[model samples]
Target: MPENRISRAKLTTDIVLAGVFGLMSLPFALMGNWADLVAMALFVSALAVRRLAPAWSLGIAWCAATVQMAALRDLQFYDFAVLGVLYSTAAHGGRLVKWLGLVSAGVGALIATVYLQVLMPIFGDTSGLTPENLIAAAFILVASLALLVLAWTAGLLARSVREGREVRRREEVANRERALVEYRYTVEQERNRIARDMHDVVAHSLAVVIAQADGARFAAKTRPDAASEALQTISGVARGALGDVRVLLAELRHREGGAPQPVLDDLGELIEGVVAAGLDVRRVETGEPCELGTGHQIAVYRIVQEALTNALRHGDPGAPVEVRFDWTPTGVSLMIANRLADAAGGPGTTATGATATGPTGARHGITGMRERAQLVGGTLSAEPGGDGVFRVVASIPAQPRSTA
Candidate 1:
């Protein structure tokens, strides 16, 4: 509900409570008991502001009680409004007012005992301090104190329940915000991984198909056998690209992980495929291979795949591409280099092995390779060497396979 409406509703309820008590005390005004009627009016006013202004309500109740004691008026039904004021002090009052309510409960009980039992009997009955009357007065004092203190305690219990509910609600909202942040982070990581896979599969295959298609078109009239071989390579590369794309699509449809990915063991087939498309590749390995986790292996495979694809698309067709792997006890380092085509052999080439407008236009291939290396706690750099050769180098640390 709107705040103003809620406030108005609370005011209405308090008014109804005050009206009911005022009607019950109407006999005081009808019987010409003016002092009692004035005390009742103060108590009714206190009840009306009990929730809306608890401190004011408490002050007003004290005034009414003082007037009744001063006038020596007997107890009336409207006096019960004191308990409601005490309750509101704890339930709605600020810290200072809440403690004051407790003090009022104790002090008001003591005052009532003195006024009713000690003073009233001396004035009305001319009674001396008898033992039996003293015992009865002591019992009334304890009962009156308990009643006032119980009302204040009930209000305190209500305050505790309300505070507890507010604490739980705040905790629930914080948990939801934390969950949303974690979910977004997971989704972004997954998207980057998928983008890397798509680039590796599509870019590499298309480069091979373009190379074989060009060669087939040129040699179709002169050498039919060479043309037939080129067609076969193109067909195989296209089919493999199609299968990889389908697997990626399937992974998107179902979130249960992806198909088996290429690893270090698959490097031979990768090199052979490019060689069939008419680029000479020389691969050399040194030292012993270290074990690596599945995620690290994927990073390595994609980095090498993207590097080779960049070379096949931008390197000189007549020159050989050199690939080397140096393995140590801790990690493996890779280097792939190829002579740049005549058009790319310029001083204006950027550090990413590309010109202002190099092959694979936006250079997402190099950026993706760098991101993949970083994901596996590795590093990569691609730049043109002083000898007019474009080199892609990467270093990856070994990690234990996960059992889960």
Candidate 2:
């Protein structure tokens, strides 16, 4: 019923106040009579326990009230302790105890009126109570009931305010926790997006550079001019890769673009660059040109780029690679294929021809390609076929035609 935690300092202060109230009431009880002395003692005891045990405080105040009635005395100053106990019962006690405080106020008023106005004087000096005495008794009953009920109501109101504040504090804490979880989920999605981007850029560039390095190595003795060209191609590919890596790093710092995203229009230069590195890449096109959103164009470009890059990395260097595009009103279809291994033996090496090799620990190429396709409302599959060949097929759906 009391506050949940009371510091040692606060306990000491309350004890001192209780002692002072008792000492102040001591003289009035001594001068009035033995019965007043007993009533004051019980009322002061109720004050001492009011906060620590509010229901018990109320019970003790009722005992003091009964003692005052039996003593047949006028109300003493110490009887004010009943108001303090009534306040505590509502402020600190449970529901049952709070109702008991209100009941005590009504019942105590009735008992005190009858004893003081009618019984006390008839036994002592008055032969009987007059009409004026009865009226005074009614006034005393109303006044005492008002003060006691006011004290209890004040306690109930204070309790309501404290409970409201506690509820608001808990809601604020829950909101903060929900916001933190959403923030973490958003950060995780962004990180996965960046990882896919890095894989596409770095893997495609490495595949081109490796093919060029192989060309330069195999051509150095017999064809000096061819070797020089291969070196030039390698240099260009490396520079592009470096620039792309710089752009990705800048993205980590939340900077705007430092490199342009590849689009379908860039496919020609992309195919030409691969062919220059010694892979025989043939291009085929059908149907009329169609407009596409930037996101769809990027997906188309990257799918072709990654397919060709895989042919250079994992297919025979002298193998013929074919890329075809079929555009319709609804969507575009794409296919890319290359020999998986040289006719002579092993992967990437041709019979009577040279081999191209590069770093080979990546498996995210297909995943990155599939993610790109999905972003454009499309599908893609890359697989090896029965004739020692690898193939890629992709279907990219188009958006509604824009008139603007």
Best by lDDT: 1
- Candidate 1 stretches with Cα past 4 Å from truth are 1-11, 17-32, 122-134, 253-256, 347-349, 359-362
Clashing pairs in 2: none
- Kindly list the per-residue Cα lDDT of model 2 for residues 1-404, writing each as its tens digit: 45335577766765677789989989888889888888888888888777777877888888887777766778888988887888888877878888888888788778777888888869757768889888999998898778888988998888788789889999999999999888777766656666767777787788788777877898899999999988888899899889888887777666234457777879999999888877899999999767777778888888888888778777767769999999998889999988865544566543212245432322467768888898789999876665767778999997754467
TM of each candidate vs. truth = 0.87, 0.73
Q: What TM-score number comes out for model 1?
A: 0.87
Q: What C-alpha lDDT does candidate 2 achieve relative to the native structure?
A: 0.79
Which numbered prediction scores highest in TM-score against the true structure?
1
Model 1 lDDT per residue over 189-246, tens place? 7766776798789999998999999999999999999999999999999999999988
